[model samples]
Target: MSPVIQEPAGIFITLEGGEGSGKTTQARRLCDWLTAQGRHVLHTREPGGTLLAERLRSLLLDRSAETIAPETEAWLILAARRQHVDHVIKPALQQGMIVVCDRFSDSTMAYQGYGRGLDLRTLRTMNKWATGKLAPHLTLLFDVPVRLGLSRRRGQRSSQNRLDREATQFHEKVRAGFQTLAKQEPRRMVVLDASLPLESVQRNVTTVITRWLNARRRQPRQR
Candidate 1:
């Protein structure tokens, strides 16, 4: 008997936002909607989607894990990203599954590059090397005020992740970082008002994604 093999011909979508911006909520909603539409969607989150990545996520999030240098944190994230892309994302995509990731390279740029004051040039190089040639077809950025997101995150019952436990200034920097990215890449990035009602936000996001998918479907097949 021979093992089965599957090839993926699907799209990659990433959801990004600062803490309490409702990214997780929206990501789940988007996944459910896509599945209902008969798409094979693989929903995952960054820093811990795979076995190796999950272990790193634990260390990265533990508040008492000792102070992690900015450059070191950046390297750890990129390392997880490289392994995650090679093992999980690439394989799922090859299986013809739409991959909806909760967070991707943008988080590293926002959290590490801007928030932690790491060099953006280095972050870009790491991202490019980690991802190889694949890029998300669409990125939904749930934009919210820094204060509002911090308040919401603080309200969560679970102790904040190490990153989340950072001072409010850090989170504000992250919010600004994401805003900058959205402005820089308006075409591939959709900025949604996350403060809006969840239902309304979800509907707007769905409409935009559906339209993009339709447009892609209309394109002529390449030889």
Candidate 2:
């Protein structure tokens, strides 16, 4: 696919959660629904979106790399976001396409801030610079107990991601981090019960998204 241009006017929706929260599943579902509604949709994932970002993804997710410190890992994530923002996401939105990102800046706060106990101030600063003041129009936080989520992860053999290899406590912290963020930004973030059946969760998600889109459409364009 050709690259999307910079400065899109469309809405950006991000799905955030801990492991096994169905972000990938729901993100794709949302994209398909948007397309069925005749809206231009772009589905992407964090730590990866642009070509360069994918390369960085490999380095960041290599579980065997024991020497990578937490601070370094956070920087790598931010760097990938910088590239993704400038090269892919920003452009897709400029074209007025709905962009469903599997994860975004929230993941950084959850993983690096809460999980790794990094300085939130530094993370926020880096995030602002990387995203160029671009905030998601809406963020769906798939809330689930860390134990259940991590247990589900143990059954998946294909996930060799280093971040996925962290201890259960780390994941618990990540979940707590997302919860904190949701509380702090209730207007922009909606925490959804992810333990429900996929269809049920999807229905709720569709309802919320449809209403948000409809409302946006009804609003008069600002000069």
Candidate 3:
């Protein structure tokens, strides 16, 4: 797909990890901090953002819903992502808003590609097509052991989803997939030890993001 809009002036940041990796919390914190710095921030999440995309998110996560085929799951997520990018992310970025998304294409690659045995290359192409090649300026991958992450999820009384019910091996594959991806794109991705206390993890995240923003500010602007 062709570019939906010219390169955006704003920064795009995404958080990725297995269940209970504190991505949502960190995303909120980052957005709050960015807003405090007088930046226009748009905090959003994958598989859901716009109305249509949210509906798809429901279908994707509903445990009572019919067993969706693996390919069907991939298409549904891509469809929601297409809507999300077109309706929310792209417009926000064009308006010079820092978009802090909870999960994005990387989740799909980790879940369906690694967890469900899908083709990573094909999924990458589909993700590019869905989002019109809009990639994040920074991605924070919260790394944690599969058992620990799953245990945390089990302890959470609310927000349990179908994905959370997957076998341990599935989550292990997903975790490994994220590790591989972070290694492949070290510049754009920062792996954080998520097993640390909330304050410690947040401190690391804030430090890394603050340094990145400062560095970007020091760079000469393009014509």
Candidate 4:
């Protein structure tokens, strides 16, 4: 595959992890922190970010009477992604706004490809087509033990979704898949030990993001 061409006009940051990895919380906090610094940041999430995409997200996550096949699931997510990239992500980037997304392409690779036993290469091709090869400038993968993560979800007050109800082994596969991706692309993907306390994880996240943004600002533009 060709190198991921991150949007040159703006920075795109994505957060990925298994269930209850605290990525959602961290995403919100990061966005708020960035906003306080007067950065033009747009906070969004995959399988969401637009009306159509949110509808698809509901269908994808809701525990329905009808069982969705792996291929069907992959198709729905890709469709949502297409909507998100075209309607939400690209426009923000073109305006030179920092976009902080809760989840993105890596989630599909982990959940649909590895967790659902689909073909990773096929998914990649589809994703490339769907997003026109747009990829994140940075991806933070908050990894936690499968059992602990699942337990955290169960302890949550909110209703559990289909993914939240997945079996232990399934979630294990997803976490492992995320770790593998981080290893494969260390420059773009940073792995965080989410098992740490909330403040510790949040501090690590903000510190890393601040340093990354500073580093990018110092680099000379490519011709």
- Clashes by residue pair, model 1: 7-94, 8-94, 8-95, 8-96
lDDT digits (tens) for residues 83-139 of candidate 2: 999988988888888889999999999999998999999989989998997889899
Candidate scoring better on lDDT of 1 and 2: 2
Ten contiguous residues minimizing lDDT sum, candidate 2:
214-223
User: Model 1: per-residue lDDT, tens digit, 52-139?
Assistant: 9988888888888988998888888888888889998998888879899999999999999999898898889889998885678789
Best by lDDT: 3
What ranking of all candidate models by lDDT puts the best one first?
3, 4, 2, 1
Report the candidate with higher lDDT, 1 versus 4.
4
Error of 3 at 4 (Å): 14
State in Å the error of residue 19, model 2: 0.5
Expressed as tens digits, the lDDT of each residue in 1-223 for candidate 4 is 9999554588899999999999889999999999999999999998899999999999988987379999999999999999999999999989999999999999999999999999999999999998889999899999999988888889885768988878889999999999889999998999999999999999999999988887877883621
Model 1, 94: alpha-carbon shift in Å?
Answer: 1.6
Q: 2 or 3: which has the higher lDDT?
A: 3
TM-score list, all predictions: 0.92, 0.92, 0.95, 0.94
Show the lowest summed lDDT stretch of 10 residues, model 1: 214-223
